[model samples]
Target: MTRHDPALSTPAQSALDALRANVAVPFERARAMPKAVYTSPEFAEAEARHIFAAEWLCAGRADALPNPGDYLTMQIAGEPVIILRDREGVLRGMSNVCRHRMSTLLEGRGNVRSIVCPYHAWTYNLDGSLRGAPAMARNEGFCKDDVTLPTVRVADWLGWIMVTLNPDAPNPADQLAGVERLVGHLPMRDYREVFREEFRWNTNWKVLAENFMESYHLPVCHAGTIGGASDLNQMECPEGEAAFNYHWIIKNDLVPLALAHPSNTVLQGDDRRITWLLAIYPALLVTLTPGYFWYLCLTPDGPGAVNVLFGGGMSADWCADPKADQHFAAVKALLDDVNVEDKGCVERVWKGLCAGMSGPGSLSHLERPNYDFARYIAGRMP
Candidate 1:
């Protein structure tokens, strides 16, 4: 006989473990994944494989690597990769690790006409081709071609740069081909990360993703900001399109397009009744409105620590204004409230489990949005 945990009941735990193997389903209509999925080290390792390794994850902006020789380096899904504008002005990527002695090639982002391994000084072109191997050649049959800084596959879509651990991985667009058509019409090229900051929050990255999937906290966490600026009572799930339970928060006069379902805050204003957020799989939250975007934390730096990255997606007016600073500050305050609400809940959950409080948590019958996220992750698992 098995001792059953309600939160980890056969049904809930089974479904959640399913997500550990696959993707999630919508909650309520589907089933919530188990708490262990969020807290387990094994689950994190699996995610690095099935999800991040296989999927097309966002690295940064194409504009960030504007000029030839300019490069940006980051670790994604545990791969130390570098993105660079080649000497030919082409965007490219290479393993940051040196092919020779395993020391990192580039220490940081800068304009380097060529990439060189700091160790033993093995050099490579901006294109990731080896240029020189200082002393290894005379020591052994060290051919540069076989030892070029192991380049990863790269593709630039719109203005975003994407890198894959797979050497011959299919294009990110192919994986997201469905997404492009679903929410493609919005002009995203003009928008930029106007505000950016990342901090370590002790919680699973999925908690950050889950927190952004619904507006349940608006009435409490951000009542002052969202309640006053937008309506919380009139929010509903958009009909027709199959939402994976992850979507963007739309605000008043602030929304620039016609959304399938209008959140109450926007219903009070004209031209602001609709905005759409494309919740790209594996934890990318983007709010696409005219001028700029409001965003949620990606939390991709391992599942334990969520790194908040968002800010202005300004339209022409916001970009050209002298008050851009004020606008950013306002966004920060508003986001701060939402973060406080979410962080409080997530931290409590983490602490509870640490204190052995793994009990079944309630899901609001009305919180369909949160359910969607639960389902999505559940489906992703096995």
Candidate 2:
């Protein structure tokens, strides 16, 4: 399918080309990252270099490392890595592969004083330093420093743990200025890590992102929840950075034609636009409704599997009354359906991308948000 994908949207050609026409952007960068970015081994490797290994990637929330020594194990750009809070209460990320023999050091998130690899009984401190060895001194000319886990770079922004697999990655604080300016005053950080699970997806990560860039698909795919409230006309992304912030606001349920303001004359069933779902480039999406929030982290496992992790957050006073409680429940249920629908669509797109029917494709006239995302992707490439 073309960039618009019937259910999706894209920006006008003139407007998009204008933003990208700057001589600073190489021709290859202006063009899409190419079909290989979504389907080929080479493109994926390049992304791993410029986007994952070299850039600060959001891994999870600070709460994952709440207490000292708590840690979360995840893969960044297909590299097995682990994030740990040392005894001093600082967060650090290191390659998860054991330094001695390449055994995985940890799996999932948990509390551990010292990570002792089950394979050879080698141990690493919370800060990723070599803490113990099965029989290191007995080996010929083996230096203890050489056996320490290779540390990756890490930075925490607004509670999200970011890992940079490339040792020479830039200062994350500087790299995130654009996003920081975009969300400066929003009450976004008041999130709690209440939920999470990983799903293996068979589609390109971008296809999944396109699914979320706008509410155009609400009226069709999510008619029961979001389609009931939001429509194509009211589904506008905010201006400038807000458009890329991946944030939205809604006051009603996801019912079709649901009214934004439910007065006495407004029917309860009218779906009228009361939700915001904003995504960061590569893959991270946040959904903000009247009283609830949902965050999705889409980490590409490989060309074949993408890890989609979901979590729920809410206001401090969500339990104020029965109505607030009810709204939260409804929001969670609606999002569940959203995930079900997205899974089917992306799986199909993955099939199409792998089929080689198309190489790299262009943007649709109405999908400006995606094109904007494309702009960010191009800027990020080395």
Candidate 3:
């Protein structure tokens, strides 16, 4: 089988071939991925087809839609999708486009009794079945029961709502069993989501994803907020698993809330201050700690833009504290500051990647997760 597709533009094929070559060597000798992989439109399109469309992507947490009518909308590889809970208390994924005339049915996140189209009054039940259509009685061929919205695949794995355009994709929970074994004692599903925000950054999605995969840049890029607390010599970057990659660093006293709460008996000794950074396959990036957790779900808007779903919250132990509100306020402030620093760093890298003289560089030992991520990407390319 050929690594490059014949239909791909010459530049895209060449870029993908370079990426494959970059990951062919052992991790200790691996170099950085070629610059073209982040700047090629054709290559991004190929990723949309083979990776985003074929794999399960995180859609925030299931707790976001607690009621039957609560729903949220997002685009998966350019296809608008709705994640909602039906009256039967079942979570579902469905087309967000109206069945009548293809107009979008919902916007952002909110609770609705039913999905009503603004264009022509087409209504749909929470389960995505066509409820009613105005002035359609005269159309002899129009059957309401036969005009329901199409269903998409959705699943709740460890409190995260995961969706996929491909029906043949493996179950996320089954594929991520390794992750469960690592963090299962923490009760990840019980963590409450305190805040969720949407953002668009001036950088490639892969750039941001790779940034989250490795902590090598934390000491420099996030110097103002989190850098001083992270010790490069203590960062752990083990070989990545098939479904995800992770690294851990012990928390310092910089932010007291980052450590385990006094009431958190689950994490003892050094585990109390350990912070885990996890990159779940294609797009979910998470930072899990003993007291709080935050995550980003990434999707590419184009070669130069990335759409992000950013959210975080405290663990049940911290939330039950008498000063829970104060603790969370401090955590949120720190996260916002860290994001500002990251935005500046990644965007600058993108600007450099666009330069004519820019190209691949050598990988650091701390970048083991990045090399694994490159291998995953190359494995999915045409």
Candidate 4:
């Protein structure tokens, strides 16, 4: 008789084994990821340490912080970090915790000349150097030059602001080179960020991420919003690389803003109608069309919740059009509806997983991106 060792069969360990099993087969024989991969707290903790803390995470669009002093703060696997443009107009990332007392320095997205700790009135320059402290004049051998917030790794890839706590993490540009080769003609770096919002959802981060990666759910779940527009047969999902997965669709002109602007002569033929769905490793999901782009940067709150930084805007061609304002208004309204539909679908999936009887089934051919995504997740597990 086979004996099960309790020490070797933890919830997290069992989930890891299931994930390995799921990704072991080729796409033709693959199945959906097991429920424990999304519902187990222990597994979530392991992911937090091995993936979120170790990978480069998208903070938001670098264009959103165009002006000096504009800054945004985020927490990656419980580490508070700040991304900002300093006085010299340099993009930087640094620890957001105060040097003296460890209080969180900044709250959210805003423009700040300097970071000031509310607990003790200790101030830091936009470059993260110490500017002042309220009562440290008489301290023994204390020099302001020696005091500064620790710098975190920050990179501007295309237009996205990427932050990482891992000092040895690979350059964002190098890692996403495949994505640039596929969408380089779209001028993604110049796309103006028109809107950004952060919200928490009552679902696992991977559940929402997998939902975005595959269009198979569009016809059913997003029927009220974008379902009728999505043709599964038109999507082209090639094999994914180590860093990202992308599938492109030749879109119809149902939404005018989804096609290239008349002035965008650079895009011709089918290129003008191509919409690329890019899933950057770990948690950046982007929907890039010729005229506009939108993205979601996900951070796990726990096994049952995800914190999202959602934003998007018009391409340079669209932004320069005479009817830019009117076009953006329509596109924004459509995005809001699409988001509503997605929220409903993914939340229900999470709820079903919680019922404890849910089991993964055979993956459809349309779910190729999901299979690649599952492989990415499984590869991240140590």
Residue 297 of model 2: what lDDT?
Answer: 78
* Residue pairs whose backbone atoms clash in candidate 4: none
| Residue ranges of candidate 3 with Cα displaced over 4 Å | none
Please provide TM-scores, in order, for all candidate models, with all chains considered together: 0.79, 0.77, 0.98, 0.96
Reference-based lDDT, residue 269, model 4? 97
Local accuracy by lDDT, each model:
0.60, 0.62, 0.91, 0.89
The C-alpha local distance difference test score for the whole of candidate 2 amounts to 0.62
TM-score of 2: 0.77
lDDT by residue (tens digit), candidate 1, 65-181:
678888877676777888888867888777899876688777556889788666687788877788887656476676777766777778887566777776666666666665566
Model 2 / residue 35 / CA error / Å = 4.6
Ranking by TM-score: 3, 4, 1, 2
1-382: candidate 2 lDDT, tens digit per residue: 1122221112222222333453234333333334445665544555566676666667767776689978888887778988888898888878899888889979998899899998998888887778788777788888777667878788877677767776676565565566666544334455555566677777767677777775556677776555665446544554335225453535443342122323223313312344556675456676654344577777766556677777775543443434654665665677788888878866876787777565544433335566567667545554
- Top candidate when judged by lDDT against the true structure: 3
Root-mean-square deviation of every model = 6.0, 8.0, 1.1, 2.5
Model 4 TM-score?
A: 0.96
Instruction: Name the regions of candidate 2 deviating beyond 4 angstroms.
Output: 1-37, 143-147, 167-173, 238-275, 319-327, 354-366
Q: Report the C-alpha lDDT of model 4 over 112-140, residue by residue, as the tens digit.
A: 98899999989999988999987888998
Can you give the lDDT of residue 237 in candidate 3? 97
Quality of model 1 by C-alpha lDDT: 0.60
Report how far off residue 55 is in candidate 1 (Å).
1.2
